[model samples]
Target: MIAAPVTPAIATLNTGSSSLKFRIFARDSLDLLMSGKVTGIGTDCRMNAKVTGTGAQIAQELPGADQEAALAAVIACIDAHDDDWRIDAFAHRIVHGGATFTAPVIVTPEVMAELQTLCPLAPLHQPYNLAGIAASGRLAPDAQDIACFDTAFHAGHSEVVHSFALPQAMRDAGVRRYGFHGISYEWIARMLAEQRPDLAAGRVVAAHLGNGASLCALRGGRSLDTTMGMSALDGLPMGSRSGALDAGAVTYMMRRFGLDADALDHMLYEDSGLKGLSGLTNDVATLVASDDPRAAFALDCFTYRVAQYVGAMAVAMGGIDAVVFTGGIGENAPGLRGAVLDRIGFLGPVESLVIPANEERMMAIHARELLETRLELMP
Candidate 1:
């Protein structure tokens, strides 16, 4: 008897600073086969995975595993399971595509070079994202590698929204605002279109509140404006990242505090935001459960900023019809969501929703579309 051919699947990788979250989807059906992550890469890395719709699970400690090793371990886990699914394509969640790539594209050497130049724009994310791509290429050389950009969803923003009040030369040199958390917003838009067509057709403000938070204004399921600008460091205060800050304050810190560029970067990106404000922990659950006044103050600041941004997003679309929340805190923190909604109650009876962010699924969808398009164009 001849052996049956393995089923083709798309693997989506969302790589962070020290973590890689991944999911495998059936190529044709787009059904999730398995999902997993390798957290704390370069430290005491732990890899965990679960086969969808089953009791099969994987958990292991990978000592000193880097991004490439983590990916190799993920592949090993998938292979260990007799799922008989081969990863035919890798769909990467690239955080920044700069100003050129407006849509998902197959990764090429030229594209890789261009993306490398954008690392400065998203220092904390872009480099790791590119590392995932490079790792996938090395480990699965025959598989198609597709880059699904987080910035691609917001690439259609108008000049007024994307531009800063900088000099014409600086604006022309790609120093303009490039919104982040767009992949999550795009998933929210698609979900709304299918589940709540009424709101999807009208003005909607989506608050992706999490470790890294941002708000996006959507009109007819398209991004009109967002809070993040130029980098993920902008927008709402994150777990450890400073949100929007005064340029003057940064200059003052550099001069008064004797902070160099690296020191400033570390302080703003890793030592600020809720973590800095709370003086306890960045985890919302911890902050919410604590009796400490600092935690309460941090939570208050977070919700207040979220509400403020909602109003800004509402203004961007001329009116507000609905407010959708997603991401870790957005979907799970009912109190925080209610606080945000309550604060924005002055906008009149706007619909409120909590939609789970499915960025990995969105990447898989993009991978399938690109794959099918390639087949269609083939002679």
Candidate 2:
């Protein structure tokens, strides 16, 4: 009798501004072997992980507390746990792919150049993602680096959905709505297709609520419209991002406060949203726990924006058949979810469920698909 071949291990990395999350999975079955994150980089960076089935936990303090250091810690942990396991490929969650790269691609020098042009579009994220890719390449030279873009899943939206009221020349230059948080949405769509065909076939609104949040309207499992437009900063307010501000308002701030582009970017991307509004931390758990009135106000504004966008997404879908809540806050913050749902109760009779964000698994699936396709073409 012939024995079946064993698929190699695949690793997915989702790099954030101050953290890096990763998971290792069995390539053939996509069964998660272990998952963890390194958080608080630049301060007290700590790494934590647990094996999927056995719940074997691992923790460490990464001295340098940077992406490179965090990655090294992860590798060391994996090696210590299972030296026999071979890491076949490393997949990444790239924030933006611009108007091109509508699918996942293996990272090449030319691909890196094209992706660099898109960094300004997702200033807070794209650079770190590319950096992670580079880090992976250096650490594991033999493993293939596959970039699965957050913008790729929404690439199929109609021009009308992606376009702004910009001039023809600007639109020609790729200035358009390229949604973020797509990997999370794609995971939700896949889960729905497998678990609830009825809802999957109908109009659905998915709210990916986290430190970075967005809402996507889906029709038959494809993005029809999304609250986020052109940039990640254009959707609902997030932990520190000022979402959906008018262009004129930005220019006014530039003129009045003598703020340049960089300063303006910092204010919008780092100083605003929950932190700015609450005069406290951007963490939802912290805000929820606080007795400060500003905390309540911040929570109110976040929920209000979510509810507002939910209505808009519903309109975009013609009608919403189901509403999905996912991402860190969406899955874990039941009170926040209830608050948003309460405000948009009229949109009901719409089924709702909290789906945990699984972008790592989704990226792994993309990596497998791309690798398999490459193998087929190698002949």
Candidate 3:
């Protein structure tokens, strides 16, 4: 049998610390062509993706460990679907940009180097972020790569919003708030601008709840403030993170529990939050479904913390126009949405909306802009 020619489309990749997600979109309107994710990288990589709307899995699945191998699998999957598809560019969700990158920038060696230095700020994520970027360069050298920073969207915050009550030296060392989970919030911000322009122009609080969660106060579609400070673990209680933890307590734990840096990292990154409080699963669905008192207590803690951030962000934004939720737990978990909103009812006239998280799509949009602009500049 003769093979059919592959249709042309733009391929966008959103590689996380341990996961790689990709989507194919037609250049016109950038319609969703296909999407999938390779998970559990670096140790027993697992592939899971459902077709848009239908939720169908890919045929030749990539099973193994290692992020680079997983990435190769994603490339192969896309190539198989449309061998001739012209991958115009690649978009990456880079986690940190220090004080430099405030918007999407074309990837370069210097930019990558500056980002790598931020590994100390985001120890668990930055190394992997760099790894993913390097892999993309190697795997798809033909496509233009664009870096969309998770910290860039929050760079709009006022000095008062980002400042910490620390010494001048520490503040000068970039030890202030640099909000994370920005891609999710960025999408929500755009949704508000398009669907509810009035709210977008007014003060609003956006909670991006998921395995990793953060709240942002946005005024005029820009970040007025956010809960996360310098790292992803500083905001709301996440799937397995101890949010807003006392630095003193950490110091005490080191002396008392004989916990080293590595031990604490494992605890904060994988053993705390819902999993720690509930003594059960970190998955919100599991906790929500279970009748265990510990699970209920954990949910209560998560809800209360989210409500606290809303009030704080409301104060930061002056007042609140709307409360937006966008993330795995945000978009799908209506119960969580209600719990957070119910607690923040004291905030005047707040409307709630759920626009499913689309960081991958957002990346595609940025890549398209970068590509079109580059083409225009070519003599």
Candidate 4:
């Protein structure tokens, strides 16, 4: 059985670049009381709110051209719905925690500042993440805010797994392999540790594939290594983000394409990967289902890149015991999963499993502990 959280008014706030998602958990059995998202931050912002247990949904168009306006709209909707619920704690899905914050943290000025500086490392994600927090302080002042990092899971990677060929000065500047999508991996790690301790104790690889994708290698339920380096764009080819490109190739692209630094960054961060390669949809499902050769090629690129990293991760751990899948494509696209698994058959006989992505619930459970009693302190 999946473990649930115990909290009266606890909700996880997942702030993306263009949207905000939240799920409220009740203390008794930690069932979802409500879930909602305000999408399209800049204009024509839309919201879909649902009653957690009943699945009753109400849709509304929220006003906003940015994160601040988006938060106000979310707050207005929550307020309009008169309920017995009183929000006690807010857990945020922070995109980056830099070098520290391997574990969840009570939001502090120092932690917030560090996350802000790391924005350049993930220019597309960190500012919006911090913006949502600042907005929370304005919109939900009574709630005790907590931050859970997406990079925390890979904090245990070996020095070699994290190093770049650059000089020590760059490494000293925190330019190392700080992996991404850690909330999902961290949740899966704990799930495995609780329900499948044998595999949890052994070397395992968890692939989180979606619009944003990455893979994590774990041993003894800790992150041994991951595909994403200093940024989310450094891993396997994602929906629109290029993965694992040579530094020299970047310079060459700049020269040949007459690409400015910002344009190059935009291409790598937003326009490359599956979209650039396929010249079509960035979604894995779309590519896998399409009849176009380019779509097939895109699928091949994605799976091939992922499979190649699987071998590298296995090498990092000496061997892999199980290969698990999560995220949109990871859990839903069995064909894609099969393609990746088929390519890495040599790494087997590793077992494979699919677990739905549940980072929000994970954050709720984490906050539930901090609100009730620290689980680590318990017997």
Candidate 5:
């Protein structure tokens, strides 16, 4: 039997619509011990996991699976290696905290219920996020579960930034800008503040260009405003989401095209964006490699939208000081980044840098903070 390390560990779970990503980290130093992802959850599912330091890996098919089953598999895989390893805290990346939660909080039955109410705001992500939490509770009944909201980092935005040009009743009913990609933005702010203090102190536009893409304007480690408003689907074109479609178009689809609400939802959330534009795969690498003119058009649209949002982000912060890209596409696709920057170069001599997404680490950090706060309050 392998002996567990002296330090406690944190299991961070990040669940998307069709995937569950997990990482275990040493609590004291925050070093990664293991990382894995389970993909195709609702279909021909598969899981691929590996021990971080060692080359040991686990790969298998997960037939007819869901997030709960996939999460259980992850726990089993971790325990198989080191049965004694203590997962002291379970941190989750919850996509929506709505207007109530401003920071990470210890999960309770009441809190979970409150979270369920906000699921309609983030239908694609919130329910799965809660499922991961519930699965963790069942798997490790004694562990402390913490929810680090993706919207928490943007909670400090001024009322003007969050306001919609609607009636006061609508604004009061939580119909206002609540930016997404905030966990990624929070991580970027912390990284920039540590690595490039000057840029971090000034106005900076950080673009998190992933499958679900958004841009944020940060100044002195705070979000001024962001491209995404009220929902995740209101920003730059994403891998599948139709970002920022006009309200009239949606109504036209319903009345003129006879599309029902469910069909429209599926079209906006599942069949749009780059995939719809290119009529091909949503994978950026594949799109970049393709000879298809449609692929080129999709890429061009993505870049142009990003550049346009950067201008808006700059306006939100009064001016641009630096531009940071960090996401699956932002960190890896230099061509996309260059295309965006070329159009927005007039906003420079703006510094440009690519930082990898670390929302998992950011969640772990929030979890640790909430834990410390609880400990300090203990008698």
Candidate 6:
């Protein structure tokens, strides 16, 4: 008896601050083979995976696992299932590409170095993203690593949309708006083009409301403008991120409290936003269920800001044809969505849609396309 040959697959990794969501897709058909996530990293971590089209599943706890450990467990789960699928490419969700790298590219040493320089732009996300890439190289050196940037979809913004009112030197040094969540927005754009061609060609506002939220103005499925600026900490207030804070307040805090860079980073990135506003959990469902006035206020603020930004996005595109809601909170929270849409009712019966985000699939699509292009160019 001879062993069967392993099937090649594309592994898509969306590494977040405390979670790593992944999916394995068949290289030829792009069908999902396995999907899972490692949640609660650095604490009581858990890994759950299900082999698509079958009953094969994995559910286990990884004690005190970090990103690398979590990814190792994911690979172990893949190997344990004997699924006969080998990951030929690792498609990573890179949070920031800065002013360059506007498209997916095969990661090389030079590319990795350039990406490292961008870690400061997305401190909470970029480092972990690159860490996953490094771990994948060690764990599976034969696999090709491809970087799919979250800022790439918005890279075509005009100079007016990308600039900040700053000195020429600072502006030239990359101190300008470079929107995040392009992966989710790109998926939404593609979905709109496929499902609602009428709206796809017109002005659209997409709200990606989750732990990290932002609004993108899409004209003809291309990003015309967005709410996020320079960092994920801008735009709409998120689970634990302060959005659209006044620069004066930051300076005031620094002077009054003697807060250093690290202190400010932690407060703004991890302690502000919904968590700070509510003085309760950052989870929207929990906040919605709470009777606390602070929770109510937090929810109110979130919806109000979302509504305000929708208007801004509409203004950016000159008008609005449709409003798209995506991301975790955007797709699930109806009351919140209603609150936002209700506030924007003055826009006169704007079309409203709730599209489920599938960024993993988008990354897989990019990987497959890049692979095909590489194969075609081979002699």
Relative to the true structure, how large is the alpha-carbon lDDT of every model? 0.93, 0.89, 0.82, 0.84, 0.90, 0.93
Candidate 1's residue-wise lDDT over 165-187, tens digit each? 99999998899998988889989
Candidate 4 per-residue C-alpha lDDT over 1-379 given as tens digits, one digit per residue, 9 for 90 to 100: 9545433678788887888898777754677888888888787788889885556777987665578887776667666662666778789988888887888887767778877887888787888888988888778888878898888878877788889988999999988888988889888998998889999999999989888999888888888888888888897998888998989999999999999989998899889999999999797777877899999988888899999999988987889988989999898899989998899897658899987889988888888777666446668
| Best-to-worst lDDT order | 6, 1, 5, 2, 4, 3
lDDT of 3 at 334: 87
Candidate 6 lDDT by residue in tens digits, 1-379:
9888888899999887789999999988889899999999999899999998786878999989998899999998988884688899999999999988999999999999999999988888899999999989898899999999999999999999999999999998889999989999999999999999999999999999999899999999999999999998998999999999999999999999999999999999889999999989789999999999999999999999999999999899899988999988999999999999999999988999999999999999999999999999999
What are the clashing pairs of model 1? 178-230
Residue 79 accuracy (lDDT) in model 6: 87
RMSD of 4: 4.1
For candidate 3, which ten residues in a row score worst on lDDT?
52-61
Q: Which candidate's TM-score is highest?
A: 1
Instruction: Quote each prediction's TM-score.
Output: 0.98, 0.93, 0.93, 0.93, 0.96, 0.97
lDDT of 2: 0.89
Per-prediction tally of clashes: 1, 1, 3, 2, 0, 0
lDDT of 5 by residue, 203-255 (tens): 99999998999999998889989988888889899999989888899998899
- The numbered model that scores best in lDDT is 6
Show where candidate 2 strays beyond 4 Å.
1-7
- lDDT computed for candidate 6: 0.93
Candidate 2 — worst ten consecutive residues by lDDT sum? Answer: 1-10
Candidate 6 colliding pairs: none
